[model samples]
Every structure is written in C-alpha cells, then in structure tokens.
Target: MARPKILVVGAGFAGVECVRRLERELSASEAEIVLVTPFSYQLYLPLLPQVAAGVLTPQSVALSLRRSRRHRTRIIPGGAIGVDTAAKVCVIRDITGDTVAQRYDFLVLAPGSVTRTFDIPGLAEQGRGMKTLAEAVYIRDHVIAQLDLADASHDEAERASRLQFVVVGGGYAGTETAACLQRLTAGAVRRYPRLDPGEITWHLVDIAPRLMPELGERLGDVALGILRRRGIQVSLGVSVAEAGPEKVTLTDGRVLPCRTLIWTAGVAASPLVATLGTETARGRLVVRPDLTVPGVGGVFALGDAAAVPDLAKGGDAVCPPTAQHASRQGRRAAANVVAVLRGAPLRPYTHKDLGLVVDLGGKDAVSKPLGIELRGLPAQAVARGYHWSALRTNVAKIRVMTNWLLNAVAGDDFVRTGFLARRPATLRDAEFVDAYLTPEQVREHTASLRAGLDGPPTG
Candidate 1:
C-alpha cells in the first residue's frame, strides 16, 4: 500500500514547524511529507530591521531548509495558486511558471501574510515595504543612494526632500525600522562632508494615539521617549492623507517633502485564506481550538492566516498573530494531525502571552518579560537575549551574535547593491498582488476543476 501523502503550504514559522515535527514522528512507510514555498529558507522576520541597517548580513536571517536533518520530506519550490477541496488537489505554480497538480490525503494551510495597505493615492506606487528580505535590502540601498544624491544636488529643496525620511506605522516593524535606519543615516552623513547631521530627519507616523500600544501604556511611553531623544519626529493620531513621488500630505493638514516612505502600517491574512471559501473573522480563517478548520476535513490552518481561538483566555478570545503564538500553534497543529491519523484524542492549544520586546537601536530599548517592565541597557540585553534564545539553530544564533559583535566594533559599511535602483519596490511588488484568486473566482475554479475530473470537457 502507498503511504499517505501530507502536503503543507508555505515555509514560514508555522508551516516549517509543522513539517519538521511530522518528519520526526512519522516513518517514511507511514506517510510522505511535502512542503511548498516560494523561497528555500525560513526568514527570521524580527531581525529584518537590522538587515536594513546593515548591522546583519541578509544571509544571516535566511536560514536554509536544506540544512534540516529531515531528509524524508520532499521540497517543492513554488507557491500554491489554488486549492480544490472536492478533488483534494492543490494547484501550484513553480518559480519557472510551470503548473502541477499535487494530491494529498491531509493538507496544512499556513500561507503567512502580506502588508496591509489602504487606498491612499500614490502609496502603492511610491511607498516601500519591509516584509521580505529583498525589501529590507532594497530599502537600505535606497536610503544610502538618497544620501549620495542629496550631496550632489544643487537645489536646496531637492536636497532637503532627499534627506528627509518618513516611516508609517508605529508597531514593532515601523518603530525598529525608523530607529535602525535613522542610526544608519546618522552615521553615513559623516562620510558626506557637504551634508549636515541636522539636515537628515526621520518622521514616524501612525494613526494610533500611542506608539506600540501592545507594549502597554508605560512601556509605550518609554519607547516614545527614546525615539524623541534620538531626534525622530513621532506623529501619533495622524496618517498620510496622500503621497507623491517627492512629498506626502498628512491627515493633520501638514505637507512634508520626502523621497523615502517606508510603509509598515500592518499585515492582512494571505489571500490564500479567502480562497479556502471558509468563514473568517477580521480577514482570517476561523479555526477550531485544535487548529483544524470547522467544516473542512483533513485541513488545518494556523499562524497569521487563521483565527485560532485562544483557549487559555477563554470565551471567544482568539490568538494574536505573533511569532511566539505562531510557532506554538504550529507544533500543536502537527501533533493534532498525528493524533487524528492514529485515532488518538486531540489536544487543544493553550498558551499565555509572553510579554513583548522593542529594540530602539543603540543602548535604548523596552521590554516586559514575565510581567516585569525594563528599559535602557538592561532592556536591550533582555531583548537581544530573547531573540537569540528563540532562534531555531545554533548556527543562526552564532551568526547573529557574531554580526552584533562585529558591528559594534567596526561601524557600518554604507555600500549600495543597486538591485532595486531602476525598478520600484512597492508593497504590491513584494507581495505578488497578481498571484492570488478572489473568493468567487476560487469557487468557480474549484467547481470547474472538479467537473473536469468527473467528465470530459463539453467545449
């Protein structure tokens, strides 16, 4: 008899964890595992800001999948374009544009998320994103290029626009991005004798009344103070009303001239969740406490794409989309999969919140570990230690630590790769806006595929 095939979509923290556990528990004769993802590595998202600041090399965060000891699992370098539940077939488009129909006895959906964007004019065309490794590197090179351009420009207004930088959203991503890249520019300015340190400005804007509201009231204030002390303009309760090639108009009726706009507002669940044709809460697929889809047999979802009920919190409370929750939920989802296969009782996922950490670059930071609020060097140490401990492999931990040490001793090398200099690295570009199917289209395509499999084409 052939082994049962288990297919997992995505290679993020959730999907990768699921695959690793399955590979460890199940024998090759019992089941065959397959992982589908566009990239060959699992990106360490939290350290992305450091990449933008050139503190860590890009390769440091992109942990390779080939390094895994689980040789039984077959890897497919592709993205799932559509899923037909009735046929139990997943349509995948590989990097080479070749399409394949993969059949599976069990399916795991963990396609992560894309940057949440609004309908603000010129935002999509002019704004840069920070979701992927490519985007981080692009932004770094782009920032350095701006500095080089500003030094050469004769017009004061043009130079001023080039020197100004704006980052939207005050969450972890936006806050760290502003803090790290601001430090990058602060140091890079000395290389350009013509550019004054005061000429370079960083503006952090968010619609929320406070920065990093998730960090709670006191720590949020602490983070705000650190950014303010670093000469960063923190604009709360306001957002960009409009964006142009060289200027952005704020909702508070202030127009600022700036060439760089890094948008980290938020993230929406991947469109793949909508393609599942299941019920959703706030754009995330609704999953049961065991991380399985309610009505879809043999299908499970987790991570940022699923609204898994937080059983620990009790009563309709869903888990927040964070790395800590995602990684834990991934393990739970895999265990439940094995339990179902063996007719064992399934366990519900329940985990308490593990506080939060924010590194504002340099010696300033804020964190609440085990319910204790900390700031300054102590907080920075805690933040780095937490991240270091959370890394999956020792190699990654060593590389990250080495990078930190080297950066501390020998300053940044403001070198530009110039990869994205000619092309626009907008949010849509990074997220592959055209890759997904709409909800209605998914239903229609699934129906058509099922019909085709049942009979011959009528036309």
Candidate 2:
C-alpha cells in the first residue's frame, strides 16, 4: 500500500489555494502532494497595476511557496511540459534541465493562462504584457525612461511620441494599467519641468463597447467617468489595427503616432494546455463540475487553463477565468481529490458572482459588492482591502500595507533603477514569449535586486 501521489500544476491563485487546503486538511500519512510550477511564489495579480505604477514594491505582490507549511507536500521547482494520462505520468523538466516522468495517482491541472496575443503585426515581438511581477516592474522602469527621454529630446515630434502612452483593451487589466500609468506619468512629470504634463497623453482603446464591462453596466460607466475626468481619452469600439516602429493605425480610421503601447488585451490558456494532447475549448481543458477532465482518468483541471462550468449561472457555460472563482474552485478540487481516496461524495463547483472592483488609480475606483454599485473612495477602500485580505502571505500583506502608507504621505519615486539593463532577460522575452530558461539560468534575475538586494558589489 502506497500513499496516493497528488500532483498539482501551477502556483497561481487556484493552484496555491489548492495546495494550501490540501496541506491543512489531508494527513501526511494519507497522501503525498507535489506542487509543480515555474516559479517558487504565487503572484497576487490584482494589484499588479500598483507594482507598475511604483505605488507598491514588486516583491510585495509575490508570496513565497517556502513560507507556507506544506507539511508532507514536496514543492517541485519545475513545470509540466506534457501529461501522459494513460501512463499516469507527467513529463517535468526540473531546474537542473533534466526531464523526469513522475507517476501520479491523481493530478490537478491549474497551469493558469498566458497573454492572449494576436497576429496584429509586430504585437508578439514588440508589445509588453502585464501578467507577472517582472513585467510590471519593467513597465514602471520603461514609463519613467520614456518620461526621461521626452524631457531630454529637442525635437518636438520625438518628444511628443515619447510622451504618448497607448493602452489596448478595456478589461480590468487594461483599465487599471492605463489608470496607474497615467497617474505615474503625471507625478513623474513634476521632476521634468521641461516636459509639459498636458503633452503627456494617455489613451485607452478597446474593441468592446464599454470599459470594465465585467463589473456590470453602472460600474462600467463609473470607471469610464473616472478615467475621462483624469484626462484619459477612452476610445470604445476601437482597436489598434496596425502598429509600426513609431505609429499605430486605429480601427476607427485614425492614425496615432506613438512610441509606447501597453497591450493588456486578454489572456488565453497556457501552452501547457495544448501540450496535454487532450480536447480543449478555446485552448482550455474542458472539465466536469467535479473539476476533472471527463473520461480522462487521473486528470483534473481548474483555473483559467481549464473550462470548468458555472453551474450557478446555469446552462452549459463554463466559469469565467477569474481569481474570485478560481480560488474557491481550487479548494473544492482538493476536497474531491481526497474524496476519491476516502469514498466520500464529491462536491459540484458553484459560486455566485460576488461583483468586481475596478481600481481607477489614486483614490478613484468602481466596485459592485453583493450586487450594490459603489464608486469613489468607498470603492477604492473595498478594492484595496479585498486584495490585501486575499494576498497569500503575511510578509506580502505587511509590505503592501507599508508601501501604501508610504505612498500616501510621500509620492511615487520616478527614478529608474536601471536594474533590467544589467540582466538580459526581458518582459517581451521571458514573461510573454513563454520561453523557460534551461537548467542553469533563471528567467527573472532582476527580481532578486528589486526584492531588497542591497546596492551593487562595494568595489
């Protein structure tokens, strides 16, 4: 008799929550849990815009896996490249670059989502994503650098182009990104007296009809109003049709010459989902209400990577790929895994939409908590409080709170650390392109530097 090996993929909201619950509920003698992920920390993605705006430190958003007491579970520092269900094995490439096939009695697939990119000419190579902590930090540095370049430039055209910031998509990520960056540039401009704050334009464009549409109609209008009041030009029913080295053609028959384009369009399933060689709905593994892949023994899927049904909403539709739903589903999936071992009844995944919060930078936010729409500081309080409460680790929560407190009295530091220049890895390469570095090298090196690694070698 052997302990059932429970292998969980991903370290995002879903996977981390699942692993945490399993550690608490399951006895060490009953099961052997293995948590596999590319990184050793779980990222609090909702507050990523705060990281981008230099409002909160980057490390504050990442919770360490080592800090969590897994009890019996082993944390594997690797990603599952392929899953062989029939063989009951997962092909994982460890930190040492060795590919090992480990057999598992049960598997939880929460590989998470990747940036949903399009073939919209030069997007894949040029554009940046707002998914990871490194990406957020890179954006902050990049924005500051742009302001510096704008102030230093003599040519009016070059200066204008440098100051122009275009953000694509009207979703939560895009909206928050635009808001944060807009505020960052406005504050950063004070350091550059030469640069006119009015000249620095922030344009937000989305193909959808409204911004923050997921937050219901009233909240969407509230979010739009906040952005407009902040002088952010919101263009709905529009998209960047084409983007060149220094220009972008909008779908609304408008050509905007700009240097910076922050693409926060949307997310697709991870490449790992395709590698599973199983049936998927729009790159997501279609899973049952129990969070298991139908007819696929020993395989379970959840999170943005899996198409789990929203039984609460009814009628054949899968749940939205959100942290709110994914976190709870993770707990249920863990319980079901234990249920199979103990001959207990499995629970069906169902959750009522608890509304959404859109942080519109500064103290402006729109929220709908328990179906009640709220705006301004009230929304902002709820938004920040919710994220702070949900943040996984105590260290992260404390750091985030401290950062916020400091930011309130003292404004953002516009200074660029020039940290990424020392490292070859980039937001476009590692975080966006899905390129995992081989054994010896790490994908995100400057991450350590941003995490309070003291000044360079005192030579």
Candidate 3:
C-alpha cells in the first residue's frame, strides 16, 4: 500500500497537538506528515501578558516544533496561502519568499485564528494588536517609555496623554493585559520619582455586560470587583467607535485622549479557513461528531477552525473556540485519523466545561473549577498552577516560574531594550499582513533614509 500524505496547517495549540499524536500513532515509514506554519515555534498565547509585564521572557513562551522528538513529521516553515481542494494541493509561501504547491491525500485545516478587526475609522491604520511575541515586547518597552516621556514633559496635556492607557474588550486577553500593565506601571513609577502612580489611568471597555463572559456570572462579577478595587475603569456596553493616533471616541459619546490603545476585542478564524471551500459556521469549518467534514473523504478539522458539536450541552450548539476545547479536539482528530488507518471505530468529540480562571494581577484572581467558586489568593494560585502545567515544555515551565520568582523578590526591569525602532511594531506593518515585499524591503528603506540624511555625496 502507498503511504498516505497528511498535511496540517498551523503551529498553535491544535496543530502542535495533532502533529505529536500523529507521530506517536504512526510508524516512521507508514505515512508522511507535514506541519506548515509561518514559524517553527508554537506560541503559548495565554502567558503573553506575563511577557508584557516582564514576569516572563518572550522566548520562554515559544516552543520550537522542529526540536521535538517527533522525527516522523516534517516541519515546513511557511504559511499556506490558498488551498485548491479540487486539486488536493496547497499553495505555500515560505520565509524565503518562495512559493510551492504541495499535494496531500489527507488534510487537516487548523490554521487557528487572527484578531477580529472592524471598519472603525483609523483603527486599521493606527491600532496596535497584541497577538505576537513582538507585540508583547513592544508593549513592555512602550509602556515604560510612556512613563519616561510623561515625567520629562513640562506640558500637562502631553503628560496626561502619555500616562493614559486604553484597552478594548473585557475578555481574558484585554482584562489580563490591563491588569498586568497596571501593576507593572505602578512598579515602574517608583523608579521614576518624578511620576506618580495615581496620575496613570487604565480604561477597559467592552460591549458585553461583564468582564469575562466565558467565566460564568458569579466569577465574572468577582473579576470585575477585583479590577474596580485596582482603580481600572471597567466600562460595559461601550466600545471605541473611532480611534485616532492620539485619542479614541467611545460609543457612549465620550472622547479620551491617550497615547496607548491595546486592542484585544476578539479573534476570528484564519482567512485560510475561508479559502478551503467547505461548509463553515461563522468561518469555522463544519464537522461531524467524529470531527470529519461530511463530504470531504480524507479531510478532518478541529480546534478554532472547526465547528464541532457540543454533545455535553445536549443541544444543537457548537463547541466554543477555547484552549480547553482546542487541546482536546487536537487529540481526537489524531485518534480518528489513526482509527481510519487501523480499521477501528472513531469516538465522538465531547467535553464538559472545566470552569474558568481570571488572573487580576498582584495575587488577585477569580476561579470556578468543578462547579466550586474560588477567589483571592487561592484562585491566583490555581490560575498560575494551571498555566504552568499546560505549557508544552519543562524548560518553559521553569523559565516562567523563575521569572515570576525573580519578579517577586526584586522588581520589573523598567529599562527598554530599544529594539522597537529596528523593526515594525504595529500589526499592519509587520509581516503578519499579507502585503508583498520582504523584511529586506523594511531594512532597505531604513538604509535609504540614513543615506539621504547624511548629506549629498560624501567625499
């Protein structure tokens, strides 16, 4: 029998888990598995705020897929541009600006997601996204820089603008970013004796009624209470209708001038999901209970990219795109694929909500696990322990824990790395966008500017 060719797109939680399972279930010569992504590392996105707050290093959250012991699978460093379902081929664009079409017998669409953006004026051009390691580093440096600028400025308006930080969306991402940064800023201000922590303002806005909608009512309220105690302005049923370089206009008819806007509204499935030419629910490919597309013979999908039924709810509802669901589904997708090869029965996808955890910096948290509610120090311990165990590598776990220990004993390193100027800090200008041109183009422009500024024809 000919060996089957399996192609998995993405290196996030789903793709990485699926690849590991495939390698374990199949023999070296039995099948060929290919993992395609823009980078060879899997990003632990949940701990991104810790990176931004200097509680963890950016590299600590990145796990290199190529270094794993799963030797049977080939790691392709590239992004899958377009999929030709009819031809069973994927158009891949690698890091070196080369494009190639590869064929597969079986395909797994798990490109994960991207930040969901809207048509709000100036948002696309001016807003910064907090989805990557670069963004986390930039935020860390930028926040410290803002404090320095504010302290040095004689103009009260400029100082006030520099100290104000606005965050959109009250979900896990936004809430965590705001809380962590607020704590960091408080610590950062002590170093700058000229600046006062009370002068800084952090605004968190959301259209939802609560801080964390996924964490249930009781826990959400507790989370909100914690933020309020920390002096974070938690505004519900509100949104930024317009965002400018200097300020944002809220839907409530309030205009706030601020230098920083950390956008974390939510995420949508990858644009590649739309190009798959399959039946999808809100951009997520619809899948059977066994996690396979009904009509596509050798196609399977899970994670944020697939709309798998939630049998645990006993209703016609789809499972949410959470890390909890994605991790389990990735394993199930691999099991079903292995079942097909070995002539065994496939199992349906189902899981009960294990509860939620919201870390509100400085030992304050809210959690509900197994239907039991927890708050304060207990919840904070549980939240940190959960994330530590969920990390992919022991090295990462140690590094993250070490940073936390050092931070508690000493304090945040307020010094900026000055790396922001060397690269594009915004999402649109970064390589995350599908615009043509390479990193070389970015470097060349910098060189041209330097040449022009050094006077005409130096003898």
TM-score of each candidate? Answer: 0.97, 0.91, 0.92
How accurate locally, in lDDT, is each candidate? 0.89, 0.82, 0.81
Model 2 vs. true fold: TM: 0.91
Q: Which regions of candidate 2 fall more than 4 Å away from where they truly are?
A: 422-428, 432-459
Which has the greatest TM-score?
1
The residue pairs that clash in candidate 2, if any, are none
Lowest-sum lDDT 10-residue window in model 1: 450-459
Displacement of residue 168 (Cα, Å) in model 1 is 0.6
Better of 1 and 3 by lDDT: 1
Deviation of model 2 at 105, angstroms: 1.6
Candidate 3, residues 218-328, lDDT tens digits: the string is 788888888888889999999989988778899999988787888899887776766666798987889998899877687888888788899999777998888888888
- Which ten residues in a row are the worst by lDDT in model 2? 438-447
Off-target runs (Cα >4 Å) in candidate 3 are 422-424, 429-459
| Alpha carbon deviation, residue 141, candidate 3 (Å) | 1.5
Give the winner by lDDT: 1
